[model samples]
Target: MKTTVRRDVLTLPVAPTGPENPLPPLRPPGDPHTPDERAKNGLPRDMARQVGYEPLRSLLPVRLLDGYGRKRTDTPLGTLVIENGRLRATVLPGYGGRVHSLLHKPTGRELLYRNPVLQPAGFALNGAWFSGGIEWNIGATGHTTLSCAPVHAARVTAPDGGEMLRLWEWERLRDLPFQVDLWLPEDSDFLHVGVRIRNPHEKPAPVYWWSNMAVPEERRVLAPADEAWRFAHPGGLRRVPVPVSDGADRTYPPRSEYSADYFFDVPDGARRWIAALDEDGHGLVQTSTDLPRGRKLFVWGTGSGGRRWQEWLTEPGTGGYAEIQSGLARTQLEHVRLDAGTEFSWLESYGPLSARADLVHGDWADACAETRARLADALPGEAVDAAYVAWLARADTEPGEVLAVGSGWGALEVLRAEYKLPGTPFDESTLGTEQAPWLELLRSGAFPEPCEVAPPGPTLVSRNWRDMLETAPARPLTEYHLGVAQWHEGDRAQAVRSWERGLERALSRWPLLRCLAVADAVEGHLERAADRYAEAFDDLCQERRDDGAAWTAATAALGREAISGLLAADRPEAARAVWDRLHETTRAEGRFRLVEAQIRYAEGDIAAVRAVFDEGFEAADLREGAEPLGDLWAAATGGEEIPARYDFRLRP
Candidate 1:
């Protein structure tokens, strides 16, 4: 009956998460809303704190992962399973350490929504997020950048002296190292996860952590709150009554008409939990320690747009799922500050709950009480607190066995800062080619320059790295990286100067030119920006032709940007020329197909636009709030009813 952790392969039809886009994410993170709005909207006290704290100016260090397409193939993902006799948890070590499946052994029922396919969607902040299971969202409000990325995994001793699976990685957005440990007690039906986020830096760090569990939407979602803060697309937060909001019982996902987030206003000292129960009053329940108090329900409702979004995330025939989430703050919009040299830790438990069906379906208060009482009987809040305390003792225990390897950014950061992080060791060996250039820059005073043609190594924008780059010898690569860091730090004028200086002596001028183009666009110079984009695209094309397919990813990325800019500048012929020069494989991608459709639409060729849609292609990078497909359909076929598959307009 002892808990054991072992590695296994989870084979699913996975769309490959293709090469990262070379372009930097220039768009600023959405505003956290004014204080007056928070006050007027009835936001709780803690929820108001740090609402706009250290918002991201740019997603530096983390590159955009828009390269994935809709085409899927049978791919074997590495997984680690933690089982005790009563319950089993399957962890995708290669995918942000997501819990791919949680099974209640005796009942032979899956507790979480186990996705049949690994389809990378653009729900993540940095793109490439798959549906289903439990995802640990960190760094920012949206899905973590690591949604489709790997995390380092190892086997460690749990509180019960049994094997536990530990997944740890350095979150680049906030420059923090975090770890998630999954285990189950002997003969226990509930799976236990202990999470820890450490701020190794001297200054305070704004941290966000939300554990999102996907479950079948055909259930009554319950949380211990009468009033909740509802956030709909293209709107600010507003207080709404739970269960029944907007003249419908929203607890039932089908009752709503659009996608929305309902963050439960759990009262002070209330047991923090959320559950989704079927008509028979039997389903999964998640309860966590006091520190992780926030509970939320995100439903893509029964409307055509919502349903279409569901189908787009997975296969067409699969059942839809809703998210039940727990977080450190009252809402995902606010980030709690983790003080210097401090770490936040919490324990979470997942198990099946069965209550009286009538009470669960009746009055909202009665249903929440029924669910809470059942959860107390199964796994009490006090017991969860005790588990957290016990976990704290072993949080520093050195890991024993390596299960999977993630990015070496943690090791590089640790090596640079001489951090004495225990349990989760970012060993020197974990460092890879991505960390090589930084390691060289750290060791020698000079930043390594590219001898041959290749995209620039990823940029580091953290203050420490930025300071180091500032002191490095002045070379083209050094200037380029420094400019990126400066741009991320909000020094636009200096960033422009650095890029212009770098371009003067640059062998590969396209990267600097692209950065300058983005800067110009941000400064409201559209035509000038388009010209820079065109120049950059031409330079990148020359490099691709000379360097062969190694530059294909960069060429494709630059080509998309250039064409979009040209189209925006009313230069359809120029955009068409850029499209014509794209590699055939790049042109065949779903994203480019949409681009082609846009180009044709801009050129006043309605037939060509309709032809592209008739062929049907999935835009893998379809943004959360954008409705490009629906817009194109409307433009091509004026007033024609949009097909169900092409409709994903979330807002009214």
Candidate 2:
């Protein structure tokens, strides 16, 4: 079966229009009459009455099995309950009081419930004197009070007899909406209220909301990438990036434990928008609202997880509440400046798609195209100019006759010299400077062999060396050898550059490139060193071989040393695998028993490693051949520290 990737996009609906009617009134307060009077009036006479004469019967019963028992009534404000298996609130009705939205099972719905109304202590409503209301002691102003009202579907009254609009709908699979619109008095300064949502459903629903609310984390106000705005918070302030293209969006995943708060300002005429996109890019819900001239944008997302007010707002590991606000600071809703009589509005939409494939064909492609165009526009123009200069420089210094001369050496030398170039007297010291030119000549495909080895006279040797170094100043091979010499003489930086230059010129010439890498490793560029060794090893491994015992032994030894070096560099796991390969290769060809013992010891099989050494020692008769094995055993058994005694080297 084949696999496929999908995408999804969410779009918002148009805003509502026209002046809407005030919502319906809340239920009347419970009767305070005696059981007989209440019965005659057709009220629930058996309702349990609490202090302040508030009837608690409408609330869902808090059974002992439900974990609260009778004492459940002694909860903090806004506690929801289940009575007759229906969810309800336990707070007195109205602004100063709490209201609970209960979640019902089966249909997975929530029912709204209100507490008793509390008017000022001495205030009279209708014909009765009401003694229930919130008391505020402002300085010396004795007492100011507020009352609560019952909760209803369309309309509800605030403590001060102000009206509010409530829109609520519940469905099993669909999420519930519990929003209240507060009707502020023409001159009111500020508004505040506490809300609670109760969920009794078996499955948790994803709940989210946006409001003119502020929390610790500064609200994140987002707009189209083209919009310009500034972000402000305790973190300081900065102008927001106006994306010239799409696919640029801001995200604030739920912060598990961080305090955050900030505000954003949308310029007077700018439109501000915010959105929440789920992980798969599907199920996007967005809100766009008009901003008052000079109003700041506020956005926030909840950073914690848990049951809050009986509602699970976020998933256990990942969930948060986000809010996008318009304008800065809290100011008079009407007095706030605006361009003309511009109406401030918010747009929101939420829906699920059939699959992510829907988004890829729609939103994702558009976003990608926009991003590509923007990048193309931003690219610097000088890149092409730089390339043109580089190509011109290469053409100007093209090689001449020396390349042909070097190429003729192999044929000339084979005719006279019995021994070939490999027989040349080249050791570590001469390898860099004295012999570098010849090596370079050999490395350049132009030369197949060294200058014919003249007789061992001083004049002949000097002439050969001078000719090799002088012939190819432009060839990459000469510079590479000189670099190697500089490196051996302790001029490391020069060595590296020379090797790099050599690599650049001869990369397509694998043999020379591989040799330069080897030189680099010998100069303590360990990473480069390992790379060179690997290249060499790969080349050797690919060639079929038999009967070349010395060559095979030398190659295996090199592999062993490289593996050890990797181990000492804190790559034990990688080194172990390399060592395994080395062991198999060496064992297949019947060589390096001591190296095999070392491999076992390095792999942490100390006992078996020691036995190998012991056997080798005994077989070699203890005196003449046992010394190395004895030392190996000592290192494996912790009698001697390996690195300190050996400096990670082995005698050839």
**Model 2 Cα lDDT, one tens digit per residue, 1-652:** 1111111121211111111111100112122211332222322222122111322221110000000001112222322121222222222222222222222332343221111222111111111112211111110101111112222222333333333222221111111112222222222211212121223223443221223321112212223333333222222223344322123333232431222222233334433333233333322212222322222222222322111200121113322333333321211111111122121222221111112322322453354343223222322123223322332222212121110011122232232232221111111321323234344454552322224321110011122333453455635545544543443344557656765676676522333344455455555667765655555455445441443543444345446555655544445555555556553545443124555565676677888886664453211101110135447656777776432212212111
Model 1: lDDT of residue 383: 89
lDDT of each: 0.87, 0.29
**Residue 145 in candidate 2 has what lDDT?**
16
Write the residue-wise lDDT of candidate 1 on 552-627 in tens digits.
7788888999998888889999999999999888899888999999999999999999998889887788878778
Clashing pairs in 1: none
Steric overlap count per candidate = 0, 39
Q: What TM-score does each of the candidates earn?
A: 0.97, 0.25
TM-score of 1: 0.97
Per-model C-alpha RMSD: 1.8, 38.1
Question: Candidate 2: where are CA atoms >4 Å away?
Answer: 1-446, 449-467, 473-492, 505-528, 543-554, 579-585, 588-591, 617-631, 640-652
Model 2 whole-model lDDT (C-alpha atoms): 0.29
- Candidate 1 lDDT at 356 equals 96
Best by TM-score: 1
